[model samples]
Target chain A: MASKLDLDPRVVRSARRLAAKAGQPVVDLARSHTTVSVERAVLRLAGVQGADQDGIPWVNRLVDAVRADVGLGHGVAVPVFHAMRSTGVDDITVLAQKAAAGAVRFDVPSSRSEVAAVKRAAKRATGGGLKIVDRRRAERERLVKRLGDPKQRPWIYLIVATGDIYEDIPQAQAAARAGADVIAVIRSTGQSLLDYVPEGATREGFAGTYATQENFRLMRAALDETSRELGRYVRLTNYASGLCMPEIAALAGMERLDMMLNDSMYGILFRDINPIRTFVDQRFSRQVHARAGIIINTGEDNYLTTADAVEAAHTVTVSQLLNEFFAHEAGLEDWQLGLGHAFEINPELPESFRLELAHALLARELFPDAPLKWMPPTKHMTGDVFRGNLLDGFFNLVGALTGQGILLVGMMTEAVVTPWLSDRDIALQNVRYVLTGAGNLHEDFAPAPGGFIQQRADEVLGEAVDLLAKIVDDSLLTAIAEGTFGIMKRPADRGKGLDGVARHDDDYYNPVTEALEA
Target chain B: MSIVRPYGDTTGDGMVQLSFTLPIPHDKRAEGAAVQLANKMGMDPALLVHARPMGDGFTFFVVYGKVSHLVDTEKVQVVERDYPLLSAKEVNATIKRRLRRRLNVVGACIGTDAHTVGIDAILNLKGIAGEKGLEYYSELSVTNMGAQVSVPDLVETARERKADAVLVSQVVTQRDAHLQNTRAMSAAFREALPAGKRPLLIVGGPRFDELMAGELGVDRIFSRGTTPREVASYLVHALVGSSS
Candidate 1:
């Protein structure tokens, strides 16, 4: 099998665990967290608070390895040496000796030095008792227990971002009543990078909307009521990838959010976030997701939004597998995987519709049982709202014919503006038509079962394996600079917002950051 | 939009690349303080933006500001399209020829992309083209997909079949997530594709420039620089020509 880059050992480890439970096909990880306050308080009590990686660059490397180790074989040492803060196991020599003896669980090489160098770096991060398995093992057990399947008949999903969490609740409730299976309160335009997660529900936001716990709790409770009233489960989602990616993941887990939009490259390609920082946050966030049993969806689909959807199709596939690899390392199961793709290729193209089918079908087969989140098209819309409506109907047909597990609703008012109720009804009517008419389409969807489709999957998998080999050889950090992932070049310390970075001092603060690193 | 959670309730993980040009000479003092202030607040120091001195003590910067956040990326609820391309004339013709009806369109910015110029170009529709506006179409129907329609309400109104199109105008590019609106509409089409068959997918805005337009997967991409003629021509050609 060909791979894109070195599979983060942590991701591999996580994938193994998820794969083990997936044999049952119905294990649910999207459970709710009832006491966010208590959990957060506990995290604070555990001395884990803000950003603690002062001077310690590449925290993502350790997080990635830890995430990969979740369900994989025996875990490896992720040396976290803090030359600044002296813990009981002060220097790298002591830490390396511990890691060698299986006392320390991590390893980090200082300035790309030798074995002793790794040891020296590892020592900087220990001293604290946070790395011990006994400290948090019981909690992990409970979080794992919350995992179970809903066995739902395709629950409907919808978005509810009004900038204000209070406003989002009413809308979310309405959507739940209207047959939405999942409700996503869109995050503020650039919420991903704010190092400090917004504390609570808010109003008056620009662009999209912000994602808040009050919003999540209010909406979750409302949906729960609706679920009982309607007899089903309603899940909530938010984003967990930015400057404080790990911190946000901790929040989501404590808050009991069912789904999170956690992608590695979203920050790199779209936000121009530092790649190393993004990956680090992703790793720790995945660990939190694993502990909280949250399902994560990647942003490979966004690449299509910028790059040509058709030409960039393979990148989507590559990203999916890489995401999968990452998720595995994070201890996430395939079912928790919500890899995204879209019906965005120009509908006018002769092969556009076929390509859509090929892509959707390929994703379904490649990662069967993953409630694949099928995205609606957004590239070619015109402000002529009516025409937008009609285009949505066509898009809906594509969703139905393809057997997409999670199909986001399409609105006609797209390019021009936000839709009103009247617009939604027409949109819903279109969806109803497709669902009722083509419900059996999947039964008829037999692309030779194992011929072209399987070959494609196999071929992609082979490519992924090959890519992984190259990454392992070249190193993951090196591959990122080469623009091998999203084909978007991202320098380690350059881009749209490098000035936002703050270097850690000898007295770097943030206890939560301290505990997690420890 | 209402706020229920208390202020600062979240840890504020979302970051913004706030860019403003100040007339300060190039200096490291202000730059250092700006980064320091953001860090003093608990935001991760990883994504700080570029803060450079413009002149005489003022400066410009693309700061990565963090705001606590929660969102699920996997579960999206939207109604939109893979692609819908049309010109003012083509859009008009699409309504007239396909459904043989007229369209009503109203457009404006809801929140703050603050780019009404985009809305004016497509909605004024005196026609950058030689043809009349989509409103003048004999067979087609149009309605603006008004900016900032509350998500819930958008769902409610988009369901109305009277309107054939919902034109939306947004110029906010502070972050790329603005595309979520288009995604919302495409999500609503699950039923339309098989039986009802919707009006048509069309979008335009300054940010929806030719290149950005394709990335958003819009049907008809009309950017700020587009002329009425070009916009109309593309819409009519795309919708009318392609469907027929």
Candidate 2:
């Protein structure tokens, strides 16, 4: 069955060649060789290659490959350097097109072969890949450390992505100071899809701004600076989705960014990105996130923009579970998961707040350790700027009540236009009041057990299970073409970048493969 | 027909549609000014609801209380009737048999609008219509000029190459970019060919469609939600079936 993303024929042909060399179907080889399930098997079949091996240590092996992919020059090709076994594919002309015009990379693996015998513990060395990391315990530790528990939640999460590193740095610092736990620099809205990462800082952008390495570095430094000042680590985030998701993840990891928006399905849904490509890229990017200690932010909030947030509430839950599954496969700890949702459906809905509480609580329960990114509403604003502000106030109230880990402040002028600094101040005031007035709200909070709130949460889970079951039975790839998620119906045989994809023959030319293998 | 139970009057109540994308953490006072600007545009302040901020600084809105200002939506007929639509199979078959040759379709992002996103949505190998792009059809040759092609140069080349259809995508309409290029495109179109033999002109943008295309002499317009299938269907129906 074809994927929601049409598999590039070049990727198909490369997979055929790779399989021929290994004497097996790439899908079968990946299924047998790796722990990822069949859902992502289609991605492996699309010629998305991985790194040589994890457990191998070579910090300098990382390069600035992502820069050149986005029209900058050749640096370390961090994603490529980390490419353990498949580093050779980076140079393979056939795979270059699928490489996202040198813009993207598929899943690459890392190795922790260097953590020598522990002198302190004496009996054993615990850090040799998943052999040492207790996934379940680590996830729980993360959850307790940050969010407390499903019953008790924490503060709001917001984003700051101005194109200029100079601009983003100060803005991120301000957000962190203003009580934002999470700061996401919206990568110049569509930079993820670009094959290469821009070299340095950029000033202008179409919507939000660009997410260059320099910008990432500048913002990460600023956040780190604030984290020290605030006495708590304020996490920084940017998109690692799009064509170069894996490569960006590598960069984020190198730069010590706290989190990255690395969803498997978001690319296909909003960007018309092929499902196979997205999955493959996501897997690769997640692997990088695993190595970098970066939390991965999924785009369930985006699903609200296209589909109805109220109606598709379950989708957020479902995506969280799937993201949980993918994050696990990529070896990401629950602590490193920032699953997303939003409060953007019309506030006029009678039970709007109740629905939001249900959704937020469900995410908290489902992932438990993930720092869930709660979004602000904007879908149905008709330009009544003042009412828009009041609506945002209600959004803030929901964040406080539901105990959301990350609360994105809603700007009242959502439907009207871009906000000025004055708007930011008022928004900050709204957030400050809610945080101050309701600082202890979570302490006294108690949703009636097994009541409408809990029941609704359960209902969304059921819907999610049904959707996943169908995905399992019909193939997630086919479901994408069928438009099971977004209203779009992109066929498996079509989409942009079809011509840009070139298949890998036998001898692809990446050097890190041997270096990692060594 | 009047509003039942009398809500605040919204008629003529002329309104200005003011929308701009700003940075996050919206300011109510700044938003008020945006609404005030609408009032300046002759729109009553009471008739607007979307003077709010768009997240990440790119807000979208529509002000529709009552335009004591009217623009004749009825007289606002688009160039939709200029061509008929064919199915994917029909589209492929028509070019092969009737044109007696493969029709070449060239697309580009004219002027300083470096955004190739919208045009790439149409003419690339992943054609918009359930099928692939014009490249998929054996009967049509396609050359996508990607981004940053000047309007005059684009016209010179399309004419030199004798394109069957010229697909123009206008993005980055910030600060009347669209208006400037719209005029440039017309001038180039006028310069590129004698009015009679110009290739079927198709204009698409976030806000433009064949209606604007007809108003500007473009053969057709495919608006934002326009599908690749619909575009393919129209192209085939027009080229194979009729011209006038």
Candidate 3:
């Protein structure tokens, strides 16, 4: 797509170059280290599942036992595989039981041939799991082709969190009927802070449903049925982030989820997951997402919630560019980059709608092929339903005018209650009214020559370039520690999950990464 | 007498001042464009009163104009607060006399909501805006579980504590996560505890609709500017004595 705005191509190039420079060190750091979660992801891919009688997952128990014994530096693959090779046991559950009973011990591989044999054996064990993921990807392609795409630009995304997976099915189906193209099962609160993914289909959760393998399967199956009925392929979304980022991504891939909220900085900034741990985990997760053909939505929108949207608009742009770089490095195409931003500028701010237009249009133009996840207003909803409804109307109008790809319908009763089904109906109606009214407004509208919209976009881009340049000089870690991104300073060495991070040893091996790369 | 109109400088004038950013530099041309855009937006005789350069290419402007619109107040309906405000003493007295025991309240910022300011203001001993939080009440046992609490864990804590009320404070309503979280909480509590044993499911946030509480499966919804006293009194009224 040609540039719609009169932005200088050179400035855009400069911003990209600076973002790449800023992200290079973090990428290098991610490559050199592996967190406990990453190692657990490897085990999960190798088909180590089921919980002990205490409901603790076998993967967590295995990883905990491994980390406790030899520590994480040697990578869990080599030790677990070596144990399997030594004991002639092919079953991960049996190995887990023996390891739990203190009957088996892990020793680092001594020779190159032994390392090769262990990796080959590990790959042999996890080959079925990789095939399952591939099968899911193939199924998604088949379904998308069978059910035609939505006849619109930004797909309406809705969320359903009934805690029980069974209850969520009907709500999700109803949302699909209400014209939502994407259904994101919001995960239970504090799930991100947990080191282990819960096992099985959980019926009870707080704030959202548990992101279990069984739950993913159930939701995917239900969504497939809905997709068939709707004749427009309905997509599934989930968070493949937090402590077990890569593990969730692997699960999401196996379930054929269409999109994943896999941000690099989200855990570090919001959930207090260690920065090094998140950075290391995010790379492996993005790799899985890229391989699964899942569009990865970055959490730059969350930054605006903590930081001022108007003042920190450039930060969102800067993070989007960085997210693009990381996604590309993980082999994701532009279309797979669902970069996130929000309509969160204080509605009371003068020209807030105009500013929102500038920001949204800028994002659309910057990553023309990327599916931008445009979030709804949440920052300044004062509970007056009348005014809130009016604000949401303007928000929908901006989304239409800017051509956002994944439009989260804004609710008039936000910041209040779990919106009733009626609230979602009204919200959907609001979106439908504006969207149907001015769906093609983008084609007819262009910023006035040298007007506020164009000027704001350029200024934000310029500032992002400057910020990226400084980040490159001072390092991304330093900037994060200084609260540059979300007004939340997270140090590299501190915070949760840092204890799980370890520098990779030469003998380390991961069959999943090897298979995906191959 | 019943009809009302927006009065700025005079009755029914509908005079308004709006500010916005233009891509052009802060110059005469940009000011003219600002006025033109304002006029296009239904502002009659729009005048650019202020213009300033934001950056190299952007300019911000404040425009003054009159809108040819009248808001008929009588035709508008709002979700007004139907309950009366009760004092803290009356609330505690009502709970003590009716329930014959202290009220147990457990509150948390469930899900990914790390912002605990809202929760803290209601549950903490420090309170907000000089109003004493639930902890300051002698008849109320408040358990503040902090941020990022899961719904299952919250329900477990509520069950263990034998809570009379479960208060959830969510500051991050981004993508309706707060609302979704509340529904999940309500559902979990409903499924986990029997109706008679179930704690009153209460949620408070800046973006919540107080009138939609029953529909969201919650016992009550508290919006922004709700004081700890308001919550305490409401708890007393709903759980202990409806006539209070």
Candidate 4:
């Protein structure tokens, strides 16, 4: 795809270089450190399962025991595998139970041979789980090939977050029947802040469903059934973020989820998860996502909710470029980069729709191969269903005209209540109306030369390049600490989950990460 | 006088400008197609004023045209703000005089709705749109739980805090998670708290229906562009004053 705005190739190259330079420090930091979540993810890959009587996951319990005994510098894998080898227990759950019952202890490996023996045991243990992940990935590709793609570019990505996994299935199927191409099972509120993923089937959730491994398997099966029924693949999405980012990503992969909301800075900026912890966790998670072929949707749109969308447009673009660099570094292809933006400029601002077009089209042109997740209006819904519907109509038009990849349908009765099924039906109708009405609108539209849209895109690109240069100079971590991206200042060392981060010892071993990287 | 029309350049003229994109390269043929498409959409004598190529096989166009449509203003139904916007001082004074204690309010982004700007705008001390948030009010005790708060936890917090109002902000309305979460929160409160002791349930987001609070089982529903002062005033009215 050629540049729509004829964006200066020099600026693009400069921005790319600066973003690469800016992200290197964080990437190096991620390489040097491993969070408790990363260790838990390793244990999960080694086939650790279930919680104790306190509902704590065995992976968490094992990591806790290891952290308490060996102080976590040598990584949980080394200590846990040494414990497994010494105890002569092939099952990690049994080892966890014994450790939890205080029947076993973990300390630093006594010798080089002990370390080598533990690494070999860890490799053998995690090999089965990695095979399962590989099988799931192959199964996902097989199913998609068999079921076929949706008939359009911007697949209608609806959501079903009924707290209860069972309750979500029917709603999801109804949405697919109603023209939705993708169904995202929204995780329950605050799940991201939790250090462990919930086990088994969960019945009660507050705002959204839990992103447990069992829950993921169930929802994936349901969506697969729906896909077969609809004759087009219906992708399932869930978040692999928060304190247990890599663990959830591993689970999403094992359950064959098609997409994951795996952003680097979202937890740090929004949930206040520590920057070091988030960066480390995001790298491992993106590795799993990349291996599983999961398209990741970054959270650049959330910036608009906190900062002024118009004044901060450049920040979103800058973040996208950074996210791109990070994703590429994690071995993800451009096709799997569902980079996010939103149609969230204040509607009262004159020519807001045109401005939205300029922004959305700029993203579309900038990352042409990437499937951009175009978010609907949340910052300006206004609670008036009539106006909200109209605003969504305009949003859909912009998506259709600009060629967004994933379009989350907007509900009209937003801010009023939990949408009754009727509200979803109406919202879907609004999308269908605009998308079908202006289905080919993109073929008939282009910005005027040197007009507001063209000029805005150029100006935003210029601002983004300057910001990238500053970020490269000061480093991304310092910029984040000083509130650069989302206006939320999150210091590198201060915030939630900082205690979970550990500087990896040279001998620390993670078979899963090594396998993914290999 | 009762009727209205799009007042673009002049009243009753119905003149408008529409912009669009075509896949064909920008040329005489693309400009002609833009005009033809505009005419089909009810614009008469549509004139293509601008045309530009956007990459390969794509063209954008801006067209000016006239329409023959008018809207009757009298029949336009809207959900208007019935409550008056009060000053922060008035809100604090009313709460102090009537309740004789601080108004405890707990706000959160319950469910998976991680967007917190709306909840923060009303509950955080910084506020939005040049107005102070509920935290700035002297008589309002605001405890913002931040994003992704569970309903059961929100209920427990409301109970423990002895809250006068429980504000839940939902930013992700995908598949009606916001609405469902609100309903679930309201139901949890109904089950947990006695009718007389239950906190005033308030849910605000950009996409809420102002009139559906009763249906959604909440005390009040605030919509877009809501200021903290207005929320504070409403709390004073519903919880402290004669309106209760």
Candidate 5:
């Protein structure tokens, strides 16, 4: 993988340095603070299951009870384990139910030995859950080895979201047989806004299926069966973002999901999750993802949906560098980084195709080892199927020529309707044709020295360097408040879930975070 | 009477191809079931062309069929473009002369619909498909509330801005959310304001049926391919020109 764009090595080093410097303060802030979702995720790992009568998760109930009784500064683990020891309730779920019912009370241990015992018990209980996560990861590796990987360079990723778990299973299997290497069950609309994860299998959803644990298990089991039949292990993906970011990440890990839509700034900018809360939750979620051997997909593709891709090309690069820094800081390997970019330039513009190649090739060349997730054209899909299909063909050509790792199939009926099965078949045909025709085109394709593609890539890289310098000076939080990335201004102190953030006290303890850090 | 039949390859052939998914696996009986369903819908000579197992117990099918149903041109009902397609100058002049003030507009995507592309295309200065949006008009003052607005907030904004027209865009129509949100919005406006004082309600989306405006309790329904010029002209026709 030679540098097709001939990017300057000196400028790349400077940009990475600036990004690491700019992201350091946010990482420090995450280390010193914790969110309700992070603690709830810890409780989930400690084997707290089920929800109350109103469908609120038991983890949420237990966390709320602990936070109310003894403020969350010391974390929920100490108070809950103390209650468990005093009541002799070995089952964490039973203790959570009793706590939610106001029948059990939690107290911070007074003696030093008592505190040590409670900490050890908390660690041991969550350790059991981690063992299960470890086993699931091992199971996935064994299956992949036996079933074999997809016989393609760029894995064909497709989405099937029928709202019902039962319905999505068949559609997902159909997609796997149709040559999709990865099947992503899109989360239900606004599931990101819900503070608690939904429990059990769900039937009614607005646009997509709910990313419940039961739904995850169901889809994983079905895909495993399909993998055995097809002899190519089909991967499953789900969103581990929004208000319940860490909880979803933990669930994805326990269910052996291969990929998670885990991004740092996506929830803060798009879903309006508080910046502080998002940062804290994303850190823990990424750690979980790293441990589960899941490739985390960052949401830099979303920036182009709102801003003009040509004008905001530098922002995508800057965000990618920042996301890379964050992912590495969380202990993720280079192979586990599915960094995202999109083909969202207005096709009517002169030389739009050339501009797309420059941007895609820039991303491809910068993070050569990372599995760059190239997204399809979305903002310009105008319901004209014939023209839309042609636009997608061009998109696939660029993906093939640039050697992207994961390609989300572009639908001709994107803006018109949820794609019918025939629409998916036609879309897959477009992908297959281009990929087969130009699969090795990248080996031969190289932009001319000082040509338009090389110059454009250089220009975007230079702008990213300047932007990173400014972000370092003004601070990333302030830059975000001024709408630096996706043109969405999200203040640190504003947005939803800000109230859920708590600064750690001197005695703060979370066994899962401790384990993950270890 | 001018009558017409569908034409696939020949004129008046009444031939069509339909695709659908069934709950049963791909088998002979499933293919027969597809034909039976098509025949029930008046495709007398239905032919199953393709059938494949979608998953464990579901099947997808493509059927070629012919029906005797004919469409009478005179009996067709549609919501034609009833207003003139005015230029930007004409629209501004008419609004200024008729109302003696700038026409105020408020737009949003209500009820968990986060897509602001449609609303932005109509209200922002950058219009879709080469036409400038309503904000380009000198005699129009626009208030774009962006995405994920609630119905109550929309009504409050409309009343506060003294809006002459309130436009809403719904892009996520899964489970008919667009229809449900439109009905709820229109009902809220009706309850909050008197008939004469309430602002004209216009709902737009890609999936909306234009003929269902009355049924959905909105004053106008703008379907796909609706440009800002059409919306501005309709505002003049309904509010300004009607009074004049």
Candidate 6:
């Protein structure tokens, strides 16, 4: 398809170039430092399992012990593995248990051969983890081939978060049967602030289910069963973000999750996670996603929720470009990029639907091969469900006309209440009607050469170029401090996880990072 | 003396529609169960208009029924606007003349509730609907603390700012979090400051019951669709005008 927006190719190129320039320093910074979560992720990859009786993860305990005694600058892998080899406790979990019990001590092995032996052991254990990830990826491919993929352009993405994994399973299966192609289990509120991932199947969570390994396994099995019954593969998604980004990514890979909310700046801007910590953790997490064949969904849609969608349009575009740069740098392919945009323009605005169409089309045209995740109207959802449903209809129509890859089914009860099962049924019916009615609309839809849609898209792209240039000049960190994106002033140095980040020493070794980079 | 009954198609018909979900599949028994439940709740001769299976072992039903219950207008009680609704100028002037200084107000969304839209609407310059927020009032200095603030931090901020009023908004009522957080906040404020020195604790949310203000240990409760001007007027009425 030709560029209906007729955006200046020169401006587009400059925006991409400036985004790359803005992200390069952050990427370099991420490469040189490691957070406590990154090291714990290594321990998790090396088969360290189970929390103590207090519900604290053994990985957190082992990493804390190592950081307390030997410091994390040398990485947790060397000291923990060295203790394993010397103590003859071959199992990392047992070693962690002993360390938590004060029976085992983490000391940096001084001798060269001892260090080399520990490195080899760490490499072997993580290599086992990699094998599992590779098998899961292959298994997903097989299932998609056998059961068949969704024969639709915009796969209906639905959310099922009942705070219990058991409850979520049935709801997710029901959604899959209701024509939803992807199911996302929203993590419990404030899970991002937790430094350690929870264990086992949790029964209680606020607003959403806990993203635990067991929960992941349970949901994956249920979705697989539903896929075979429906003859169309159902994909699973979860947040591989927050303080434990890398650890969650590693777990998602092991559990065969197909999509992850893995934005680079989302944690920094929204969650107030330290920029350095988020950057370092996101880089490693993206590498895990790349290896696991997991599509990464960036959180540019959130900026519109905090700031006005019309005014902050360029911020979303800039963040999308920067996310693209970072994901590509982390070895994620174009197809794995689920860059986000939302239909959050005030419905009362004149020509709101046309504006939404222009924005959605702009995102679609900019990243032609990427499966853009188009969000629905959230900021303007009044308690009036009648009007909310109509807004969602317009959202669905715009999605169909713009060729969005992933459309999150919007509930009319979004702001009114937690949606009932009947609400979801009605929402799915709305989506089905619009999608089937306008299935072939995109093929014939074309904006006039210099029409409103065309001019608006071009204007957003030009503004995005200017914003990216400013970000590059001030450095991304300084721009963030000045409230450039989301109108959130998150200083680079102040946030939750700055204490967990450490500069790598000369002898620092993480076999997983080494393997991923290689 | 006036009495009222729910009206659907005709006046005084006592006809009403109720929708609910039961833990049973969509079947004749499920419809019968819904009717039975409605009948137990004072609805007689209930009609099961619609039934559908929500998921496995769950059914949703819409029932139309007639109830004998009537509301007596004279005996009915509600939280009326007892205070005068002042304009922005009246509020600022009242604060200036009575308090002899600008009133300090601190607002936040305490606990793990990250939703700030409600608080922002009440505190930010660009308020919800047409009325401007408290920040637009010249004699009311507003400090909006954004979201996810802990109760202890809120108390300390209130103390530091010497706030005359602390307005807290809770949007996420999941698992009754808004109620729990409000109780915790009110209790913390009570514990930290003497009754006379304490700031007026006001909680607002869509789900909060306006009549539960005293039970929840707050000075007042603002339900949904509360304009910022109403809040400003209430502050003046409680702190400046009433005290004066």
Ranking by TM-score: 6, 5, 4, 3, 2, 1
Individual DockQ of the candidates? 0.05, 0.08, 0.09, 0.13, 0.34, 0.51
Q: Please compute the TM-score of chain B alone for each predicted structure, in the order given.
A: 0.48, 0.66, 0.85, 0.80, 0.92, 0.95
Instruction: Predict model 1's lDDT versus the native.
Output: 0.53
Error of 3 at A306 (Å): 1.7
| Ranking of predictions according to DockQ | 6, 5, 4, 3, 2, 1
Go through the candidates in order and give each one's C-alpha lDDT: 0.53, 0.57, 0.85, 0.86, 0.92, 0.91
Clashes of 6: 0
Clashing pairs in 6: none
- Quote model 3's TM-score: 0.73
Q: What TM-score does candidate 1 reach?
A: 0.52
Using lDDT as the yardstick, the better of models 2 and 3 is 3
Candidate 5 chain B minimal-lDDT segment of 10 residues: B52-61
Instruction: Quote each prediction's TM-score.
Output: 0.52, 0.58, 0.73, 0.77, 0.90, 0.95
Q: By summed lDDT, which 10 consecutive residues of candidate 3 chain A come out lowest?
A: A414-423
Q: What lDDT score goes with residue A327 in model 3?
A: 90
TM-score of chain A of each: 0.68, 0.69, 0.98, 0.98, 0.99, 0.99
Q: Which parts of model 3 have CA positions greater than 4 angstroms off? A: B1-146, B149-223, B226-244
In order of listing, the candidates' clash counts read 244, 73, 15, 24, 0, 0
* Candidate 2 per-residue lDDT over residues B96-188, each given as its tens digit: 777888887888877655455467657655443234666666677887775557687788778777887888887655455665676778767
lDDT of 3 at A428: 84
Residue A170 local lDDT, model 4: 80
Off by over 4 Å in 6: B5-16, B27-50, B57-59, B63-69, B87-90, B130-132, B135-139, B242-244
The native-contact fraction of candidate 6 is 0.39
TM-score of model 4 relative to the true fold? 0.77
